[model samples]
Every structure is written in structure tokens, then in C-alpha cells.
Target: MNSPHNPLDADTLRRLQEDVIDSYDEELELEVDDRILDGPAGLSDEARESRRVYFRELFRLQGELVKGGAIKRITQRLNPRVCRVAALPAPNDREKTQWYFQRFVSHLPAAGEIVLFDRSWYNRAGVERVMGFCSDEDLEEFFRSVPEFEKMLVRSGIRVIKYWFSISDEEQSARFLARINDPLKQWKLSPMDLESRRRWEDYTRAKEVMLERTHIPEAPWWVVQAVDKKRARLNCMHHLLAQFDYHEVEHQPVHLPPRERHEDYIRNPVPADMFVPDIY
Candidate 1:
């Protein structure tokens, strides 16, 4: 019988295997103790030597992972002022009365600013279409208007970059399962998210139609293979950075002035009741 999900590619399988191995290695590292190292109950000399080498390599690799924080520090140097807006909420009665594009206008970036819309006007093409939040006429209007809307933005000197994160059905299921099992992530699964999972094919079809209609020269859509989260983030960041010829700005050197101590200046003590317990 043919499987509903696509078969895992060799690359994906390798990644998964690596993830599993890492997880198991971490657990083993945590559980290691003096007894295990001492080769308890007459372990072979060769076996003991192999165990020592394995742990030595594992600890060395773990140290490298800790040092990987340097990559994050380097990326921080490229940080532009970013305004991240959460996904647009379901339209209220007032919003329904207004033109769909009107709400998005307020969230648009200023000349030198960058605004990231977690979910944008594409909701009309995806969720709104699949969930019947908008009528067929409304959806058609969005499809007709979006290309021109984007063209207008480009003409106004706003660089519009669009990304569609593509994940396989099987990978999505695994993610949903992980969220369900994880207490911290349970809040991410909304009723709409659950419903969308049920209508995956419908959403997929809507996405295809959206891409076909709205893909324009002014703002072409870039699809990111998102089944591997780390790779997806790195690829997305790399592609986004390549969009413009941005260079680091030269800044005047900053000098810190020494603090002046005034004879009359006195520090006040806080009341004991005002302090919170230092639980940590």
C-alpha cells in the first residue's frame, strides 16, 4: 500500500539519525559515573579503553557545541532595528467592515525600518480560504489585488521579500506530536491549528493557488525547506541577507565619561520587606 506521506529522503534520514544519536549520547554523558569509568566487575581491557575514548570524544564535541555560541554573537553584530509583529488575529466585526489591505498598511515598515509580520495579508489566501472566514468573492478580490499591491510597494522603494516555509506532512505531524507532548509548547496549538491539521490537503491546495496568483516580479516568493529547523533558519537568514548590498556602518568612537562623586550624595537602603526572595 502506498503511504500517504512522502518517503523520507536520504539526507533527512541521515539528519534524523544524527539527532537520535546526539540525544542518546547526551543521556549517556549525563548518566556516566566513577563505577562506569572504573570498568566495574572485570570488564575487558579493550572494552574499558574504548569506553574512555568514546567519552573523551563526546566531551570534546560537547565543548565545541558550547563554543558554538560564538556564531550567535557574530550574527548579533548584523542586527538591524527589527519590529516583529505577531500573526494577525481573526478579524473582528469592525475589521470585517474595513478593506482587508487597510489593516496591513499600519504594520508596514517606515523608510529605514524593518517590519516582520509573522503572518501577513496572505491569511486571505490560506487560512481564510480554508476555514471559510472570507467569502469566495473576497478571496478572489485578494488574489486579483495582491500582485498590484506588492508592485505598488516595490515602486515606493520598499523591498518586499516573501518566504514560504515548506515542510513535509510527516515532519509537520512529528512537530505537532512534539508540541502536544511538551508542556511549554502546548499553548502553541490553538483550536484553529488543530482544525488546520485536519484540513492539511485543503490548505496545501490553497497555498498552491496563492503562489500561482500572487508570485510577481516585484515580490517573488522564496520557498524554504523547513523540515530541518536549524537548516531552514540558516538558509532563510542567508537568503534574506543576500537581498541587498548592505554593509556595516562606520561609527564615531564612543568615550565613557567618568562618574562624578558629590559629597552630599548618599545612597538609601531598601526596606527588607521590599526585597523579593532569592529563590535561585
Candidate 2:
């Protein structure tokens, strides 16, 4: 059997090493919480000790999570063709006037294509309902309509897979705190996220209702225990793969063609003034 291709040249290998270090550094930056590391003011001795233990475990978990080049390797090897859409909350005008399901129809994948929604029409069932963005009647209608809408999609030869990442309140709080503390991650926290944190119970109740109401045979909701970020990602990927009986397609081996040189052809040198200063 032919050996697999080593695509990385010396320069590429060096860049890959730098990328791995960068990834580890980013993970470390997020996991290092100042409150826990510095020992927060006015904390009891027992609380300080608890915080230290928590930080240690958190660091260990994060270490396990940050696998250098794992994501890049996986994506390169198992490069499944997929279209991703961020189905965020509708604008104020659309929320007031547009039908919720109408907007999603355009985003439906073509035949043999997989479209992964970052969020979906289920916004009405979760955030919109909990945040009072949708009226009670509108929320009730959404609960009534969604199962049928999904059923229709399934009937139309579209396979629907749904996942709900379940995180504990404590874990979420810690994540929020981490994001707030880390400048790089602070952008992830929105006013809506803070409000969601305050109305956690409401969101929980909404989730329960959504699952109970919309868990259909065609597209059942799969809940991933997402407190452990690494585990949740792995489990979700595994489960998603298991949903389809997919196999690798055989392909003809590729051969690189040699470039023909022309003696008459001469390359022009780029002007030194046109080059940007290499600050790095």
C-alpha cells in the first residue's frame, strides 16, 4: 500500500507548531480566571481553598481539551461538505411583521446537502419566549407549528438532526465569568446573554417545554451534557456521524504535473516601495 502524503514542508511544519502553541495559549487565557487565581477579597479560608481546587480541576480539564492540531487534522481528514447558517434572532421589524418559519425556508439545504443551523426557528421556543420578545399567543402557535414544520421537511426528503447542549447553572456562571474576565472572549458575552443568565429558571422551563412538545419521531432532540466542552464536542460529533450510514468514497490518485519552462519568459521584480513593512 502507498504511504499517506506528508503535506507539511519544513516551513508549513514550523507554522503548524506555532499554531498549536497559539491554540494552547488561547485556551489557557480563557481558563485562567483572575478571581480564582488571585483569591478574591472577603472570601473565607475554606472558600479560598475550594476556589483553588476548582481552578486546579479546571486547568486539568482545559489541558485535556486543548489537543494541538487535532481539530485541523480531523477537518482535513473527515472533511464532510456542509453549509452552516447562523439563524440568529430576527430584527425588531422582522420580529414584529415577518412569520418566523418563512425566513428559514430559504436556508433549507438542497438535495444531498447538509445544512447545520447555529440556531434555528426554535428561537421562539427558547430565547424569544423566555425574554418576552414573543407574545404568549405567538409562543403557543410556535409550539403547535414546529413539529409539523419539521415533519414536512422530513417528508420532503430533508433529514433533520437537532442537538441541545445542556450546561449546568454553575458551569454557565463560571463560563460567563471567564468570558467577562478574558478580553479576547468578552465579545461573546452580550446584554442578552447576561439577561439569559438572570432568567435561567425561565429559560430552563422553556427548554423543558420545547423538548416535551417538539421531540418528534422524525427529528428527535439529542441533549449533549456540555459542561465539559471537549467531551460534549466529541459526543456530538460521534452522535451526528452515527445518524447517517456514511462511507468514504473511492477517488483516483492525484499526480502533480511538472511546470514547463519557457526560456523567452522573464519574471518582473516587484517594486520595493510596493511591499508592506514586515513588522513581525
Candidate 3:
């Protein structure tokens, strides 16, 4: 499909869906909507409210996994053997992303290779540039800084693995529609989404330039067929783990234990005068 307006038939849809799903982070999806919601002007009133409801429900579940303390290793969040999920948001820009990631990264319970899902950091590819979200000079500065940054990361004795998940205009629209139509997935949509959707070709052009400029021998963007999402994720995971030359990572050493002890640990009652609690 030359343009985003072009619709894909059912067969095309399935193949494209698989491609989109392939690029999924297994743990983090990192889509346009997420980037928009996290940064930029933000979402609309109704859409924001809708997203609030979705994230509340979604985080409640993710939080359950966290508080249950059933999962100790960070990778377990993505391990298909443990939690089989597809297409999640990667908050590289968020303090929580940077902080939690630092913690999660420091301790790898299992041995595995480290492969980058997105070969080139997305900020340069299409996300920051074409959208006018990032200034031209800022974009140039980022490009100049990336090589040295990556050089250091590579010298750390960590293998630099990068994968560029590419989707056609047809494929992107299909997934966008899927997000729009599916309520469970509706939170995936954002106001900036339509704006980006309109510029599929322009984005593609930027992606090409991004690859040309940034693809270094040390860490280059690997353009993968994104017509199928599962294929992309599995391929990415396989490549990533392979980098580590890892032996079998022990399954959750911390088992998903049944709720053992329960107590009414609710705020303990204090003496009447000792503590004057808030009077609602």
C-alpha cells in the first residue's frame, strides 16, 4: 500500500496483524499512542477519561503481580514461559521507566543475551522528528550524541542487539483500527494517533533517513518484516536471548504461592487523645 488510506482486506489484515504483533516487546509495546500520552500536549477530555479507566484496570492487574511479590525477576514480566503478553508501552522517557529499568536491569535472575528490540532509538526514527514533537536542532544534537552513548554501552562488554520493526501503511492502519474498535485495546488510541496516521508515507521517509544516518556497525537498525507481530516479538526475543549465550534461566525461583497469611493490617487504632486522625 502506497498510502495509509488504502485498506487491507481480511487476508492482508491477518498477516499485517501478525507483523505488528511480532514487534511487540513481549513486555512493552511502545506504540505511538503511549508516546503521545506520556509526552506532548496530552489527550482530550473524554479520551483522557476513557484512558484513565483503562489504565486503572490495567495497572491494578500489573500491580497485583508486583505486590503479590510472586515475581522476583524483571524479565519474568516478558518471559513467554512466565507471562505471555504482546505489545506493551516502553517508557524510556519516564523517571519510572529509567528508575525501575535501572533496578530491573541490575539483577538478571537468569542468564540470557541482550538484544535491543528497536534497533535505532525510536526518538530519531519517526516518533520525535516528523511529528514536530522534537525540534530540528534538538534532533540533530541527539543524533550526534547517540554514537558516543552507544559506544560506551557497547564497550561495557554487553552485546548491542537492535531490531527495527517496520510496518506498512496498510498494516499500521489495520492495527490502529483494531485499537479503535476493541474496547479492551481502546486505551491504545490517542489524539495524536490520527495525526500520525495521516503521515504514514512521511513517517516511512523519516524511518529510511533514520536508518541511513544512524545504522552503525556497532549498533545498526535491523529492519524486520512487521506484517506479523508475533513473529517479530519471538524473533526479537530469540535474538535478544541469543546475545547472552545464556544457559537455561531458572524459572521463577519464587513460585506463584497461594495466599498464605492474611491480617487486618488496616490503620491500627490509636488512643483517643494520642492521635487525632483526619475528621472527614
Candidate 4:
């Protein structure tokens, strides 16, 4: 295991390369290509020109999200349990018997913590509803109750901001195909995902219904145009940062305490066989 400060190893280098390739802005790529082909400028200059605006904006916006130096008691909760349940095994009989939102209630953020939900209870309105895992009555009930539930969350000082990432079918299909062809990403192409690809129209309809019914002033859904991954991430973060009125927090000067040392203290060495090979 390399230290965080160390340079990347072979596997890490390959992964980073792959990620860069995956997120390569095609629109930028075309512009750069056109400039290089038609103009007197070199590849580097054209490429730099294409990325300058976006990268500049992205970094500037990201700085805002990072620089809020505060310990303010704004509680936001992310339901990791819900995500685990979704990705892991099916809900057992007991879980099925419990009130649908009951499990989620415990995961709500306490005062001062921030809670975020990736899939959230809206799973009922999307995948579960589309896949026939949940009944029509359950679906209707979820739609009916979601607004009030969100309103209650707002009343309790939990700021709920929901975002739906939208991509065109052509972009989605291209992304799915990319995953299928890439051995490293193949695991992401599950049967459920493939099924969702087949039922694109169904998901769109479900999303429309969800937005219509659940669009409360307290917790309205924001749709992100996500065909471009880089733009989507930057745009979402920028939007989220804009939602808060933030000021830099004041802090007292820090003083490091002197380290205590004992002359008699000695560290022990491990056996040669105990050390793993430095393969990298």
C-alpha cells in the first residue's frame, strides 16, 4: 500500500487513465479536432482552448463548496442503510412487513449533521414501481404520502434537496455499451440495469409522474442535464453551493503541543516473512 503522498502505482495509473478517457468531453474533442484540422494552431493549443472555460468554471465553483470553513449545526443525513439494502440482497420477510418508511426514519439526520440520499424513498416511485416489485396501491400510497413526508422533514429543519440526473436515450445507450465492452466496468452492467435500459420509456414516465406529484416548495426536485458527466458533476455541485448562504467561519490560532519522548522507548521490528512483497 503506497502512502497518499506517493506517486501512483501501475494499477492506480491505469485506473486514472481510464477515468480520464471515460470523462473525455466529446464536444470539446470535436472542437479541438476541428481547430487543429483547419487552423494554424497545434493540438495542445486547441485542446487547451476547448477545456479552458469549463475547467476554469468547474474549479472556481468547487472552491466554494470546499472553503466554507464552519462547524455550524446544519444537519444533513445520507441514508447509507437504504443504499446498502438496494445494492445488497433483497429485503427479508421482516423488512417487507415493516412500514415502508419506518426503516428510513431512523436514518434521518440529527441536529448538526448533513444527510443525503442517493436513491432515497423515491425508489418506490422509480425502480421498484417499474420492475413490479411494488404493487400499484403501494406506488399510489407513496406518491400521496411523499409530499407530506418531505414537508415534515422541512419543518424539522432537515433541508431536503433532490436532484434527478437526466440523460438522453442515445447517451444512455452509449454509456451502457461502453460499460459492457470495458472489462473493469462490466460489473456495473447488472441484469437490472440491462432491464432498465430496455424500459427507458417506462422510467421516463415514472420520472414524470414522480416530479409532478412530489414537487413541493419545501423539497422540489431539480433535474440535472447529465449527458455530459463533467458538466453534470460541476453543475450539480455549483447548484448545491448556491442553495446555501455561507460565510467563512472564524477560528483561533492553533498551537501544537510539544511531543513527549522517553529515552528507554524502543520500537520492535517484524519478521522478514511477515512483510508483504513491494510488487509495485
Winning model by TM-score: 4
- lDDT (Cα, tens digit) per residue for candidate 2, span 177-250: 55654466679899999999999999999999999999999999999898755456556655666676655555
Cα misplacement distance, residue 242 of candidate 4 (Å): 1.2
- List, residue by residue over 1-280, the lDDT tens digit for candidate 4: 2346655557555544444453454334323422322222333565555456555555465446444400010111123332122222355789899888776787777764455554478888999989999999999989888898989989989888888989999778767656665577789888999999999999999999999999989999999898767667667877887888887757699999999999999989899999999999
Better of 1 and 3 by lDDT: 1
Tens digit per residue, CA lDDT, model 3, 41-125: 3345764554444434334333333332011122344444433212234344663334222423432222233222321345544
Question: What lDDT does each candidate get?
Answer: 0.69, 0.67, 0.52, 0.67
Q: What is the TM-score of each candidate against the true structure?
A: 0.73, 0.71, 0.51, 0.75
Per-candidate RMSD, Å: 10.1, 14.4, 13.9, 10.6
Q: Quick one: RMSD of model 4? A: 10.6
In model 1, what is the error at residue 225, expressed in angstroms? 0.6
Query: Which candidate model has the greater TM-score, 1 or 3?
Result: 1
Alpha carbon lDDT of residue 50, candidate 4?
Answer: 47
- Which prediction has more favorable TM-score, 2 or 3? 2
Query: With candidate 2 superimposed using the best TM-score fit, by how many Å does residue 113's alpha carbon deviate from the native?
Result: 1.3
Which lDDT tens digits does candidate 1 get at residues 189-215?
Answer: 999999989999999999999999988
Worst 10 residues of 3 by lDDT: 66-75
